[model samples]
Target: MPADQQRTDLLPADALQGKQLGLSVSESPDLDRLGLLDTHFRMTLGELARTVIIAGGSLFYGGHLQPGGITNFLIEELQRYGRRDRPLKVCLAWTVHRAMTQDQIAEQKDILGLFGEIHFLSPVGDRLDGPVNEATIDDPPAEERSRALTGLRTFMTANTDARIVIGGKRAGFQGSMPGIFEEVLFSLERKQPLYLAGGFGGAALDVIRKMRPEYAEWFPPAHDMPVPDDRFLTALERIEEIVSAVQWDGFENGLSEDENRLLSASYRPSEIAALVGKGMGRLLV
Candidate 1:
């Protein structure tokens, strides 16, 4: 069907209507060298978010809050094109907000609260008391912090109808597993519709590399990509090993083999958004 006709057919019964779509995005520090820049990353995400918003769905955000950061960038885009009914919902784990000053915490809440509801999630164990601040509270052990992040992602994945994963750092992350990796794994286990736009590269591309090496032809050579530490590599391999037990050839995210192939290769925002929209459209939801 033609694009205009597809939109017309969607009408009031749009598959995207009222859906809580999760977004997992960030940059690989070396993303610019891979042919996609920070500007490119935001634009692609903005376009994807816009598409979902226009169809009456909302985007779930779980990112760090800072001046002119990626989270604020998405807010600005939503301000330009989003409706009041489709406000952006942001989730913050304890570790994320704890790193901020009290003033920054208030500032972030004021800003994001204007867009949509803000979820302040607690750590998996040992809840802290007092105002959220970096100085007042001691940082949890690396292991506990890792579990907190996983708890947050698990909550986000469980709540959202589907998930879209983009760029992310694969190493030196605070979690036992990389953030995006945990999200993807949980999303797969829950059988949520997963859209991995690996063309932009990062952990998402690394996932494609591990699960579908043939798709690497669509990405730049990984020779210059940062080599992860043994711990990170070990974590990644173990996660992959666990996910592989499902005994599937690929992620069963409501897309066919050919569609997923393109989803892993295409860097264009319109193409990526279209494919995601296509996959979500196929869902029984």
Candidate 2:
């Protein structure tokens, strides 16, 4: 059997036994204020990566072709602890754009060398420029961009066991909250565990406000300029509507066809690590 087929053949329980953890974060500057770049967050994420590796699992992260950010830091940490015997199994989902020059592509390839599995989600055809940050640059029409975004979400969802989203700006125009929201919706529908860390307040905070309003106090004050409740609500409702309108077949990943599973929740980093550790133990035993 082919390698990809062999991977997809594993039962959901067996896949969970591998303890794969996905980390999703915003590239917005607010992440810095949230202390996501600090030693504590790095140490925590590194420790979690180490724990997952030691348990014979893998780590996955997705992002644009940039060098510095939470993704780079995570890559560094994983490389530090990566062992040849166990090999720090890592996967990267890189968003490629038409604007990328040959040099840029080479740089991306060099960076991807650290990962065990690499997946590229690009536009359907050559366009003038790529989607800038969260918005399109000016070339690709809206419909084409939409298709690319959908494909990227589907690919990421099918390839990971669980997801962790952190420090997203509330305003979609300011960051990639729209895409992240869609990913969260997909993961929730697939009955995959989701950890939303909104300590700095952004899209994650907005999600918390909508999904679990009672936990309002748990989130910190909005680090960036505060987005008004009315404005945030409007965007949230729009995303929710999009999610509801879609009829997901739940066949993207090779898990059981049972769609009734409850597999999403909000939690802190420590709590997330603990839950992952517990799940790994149970599945391995």
Candidate 3:
């Protein structure tokens, strides 16, 4: 294929009417090198959201790699090209007791104010307490945090039309890699349109490397990609070991009953997008 033809856009314009589009991005430390790829991906997302709904996790919304460091970038794009009769909606999800501080939550709320709805996923007993600071509160157990995050991810996947995972470093440790991995897993289980946009090296790329090595030609790692630290390498090795041990049936058996239920309710992006194009309206509410 010619290089121009090879540089094809993934989603067709008419395919996005009222569907929900999810974006999963990494907060990689190599921001300078990855910025270009991030910009292009964001632009593509912006164009796609001219009609469809765009949804993403809060962490990526405020990350430095995003041009302008606010979710407004997406909102602005939607406002620019979206129809007045049927405005595009933006959806953001965040956890109540995760690594984010109260100040961070307030900041995110301000950005979300310019766009659409924000979903604050939380546990039953956790309450939003006192003074907001820059520091993260570690009150929740690791297991609780993981489960809560996974549940939120499953909900997002179940509700969204498609998901696009972009950029990052270590497969399991760095930044939002674990959450991204979990989201990808849920998308896979639901058989949603999950596109791994691995222009910058990250967990999305790492998983592609692990599961679909033959497609490496399509997504090469960044030229100046930093070497993984010992911790990252250890985590990667552990992931390889786990992947080696688990068969398809065993992997399916590992999920909890709730996860199974969420997967069962999920819809394909194209199906939802088609429904939207035909005036069935937004299914994400």
Candidate 4:
């Protein structure tokens, strides 16, 4: 027989506590175009952190029950901070448009439950403005689009000093190499710290070298991936060439201070637990 499964309705109560504190535009950082883009990605990063806290680290987060960028980063950061075994508390806010369904929510809950807590977002039926229908990834109307991104931004910006911190990695100026370039531009303008993944392509690195030499430092020393072939070797060589051309500080290691500071601040466990469910461990309330 397949293993028996049971359901538990009682979730930890401390799952949602921290409130967002928005910062005045004047008090915000001096963001260039790239900085603006980083801010957006950082917002997502914040969301990810929140998920981890709710799920309690022992499990996954975001209701999808998978380890998202923020959760993985938190796990890594916590390990870096020397508390690898501690359990974490977290809260989450997930928005859903009418176009999406309850079944979808259930599925996501199952996933997120694998890691932490999740609070789904819903505009008052007919009470809030804008189209309530869910829009596809390709063509979301302006109002619908705003509906999706604004609440999180407002919550995050207004709650600048939120207990949970937020940050992300950048590939030079692009959000993530080999992805959407426009979105990458937006991520940069937001001031999200560039992060280097081991697998970033050499050709993509070359573009960064030509366009924004200053950010080339985020790339770490590259190693071969599971796949071994002439093409991969050639790509690795090209990436090395790009890294060699840039004169950025910590090019072979990680982000610089100003960048790292933001990352550090946005990843506090207490704060993240507020947005994401706290992970497995003792809950202190």
Q: What would the TM-scores of all predictions be? A: 0.84, 0.62, 0.54, 0.29
- lDDT against true structure, model 4: 0.31
The candidate that wins on lDDT is 1
**Candidate 1, 66: how far from true, in Å?**
0.7
Give lDDT tens digits, candidate 2, residues 96-153.
Answer: 4544555665665566465443454555222223233443243555565556666666
> Tens digits of per-residue lDDT for model 1 on 1-285?
774444223313346676889998877655776667777787888788777877778788787777788788877777786476536877777777676678877777677655665666778523344445448445767876787788788778877888898888867788877778877777767767678888778888877777778876766575755667675577568657756776543357667778788888777777788778767777734
- Model 3 Cα lDDT, one tens digit per residue, 144-243: 6555555556666766665655555453442233656656665565555545544444566665566546544444566775666565555455545545
Candidate 4 or 2, higher TM-score? 2
Worst 10 residues of 3 by lDDT: 56-65
Flag regions of model 4 displaced more than 4 Å. 1-96, 122-140, 159-285
Error of 1 at 117 (Å): 1.9
Q: Write the per-residue lDDT of candidate 4 for residues 159-182, one digit (tens) a residue.
A: 222222122212221111221222
> What ranges in model 1 sit over 4 Å off?
1-14, 125-135, 138-140, 224-226, 248-250
Better of 1 and 4 by lDDT: 1
In angstroms, the error of model 3 at 166 is: 1.1
Total clashes for model 4: 79
Candidate 4's error at 137, in angstroms? 13
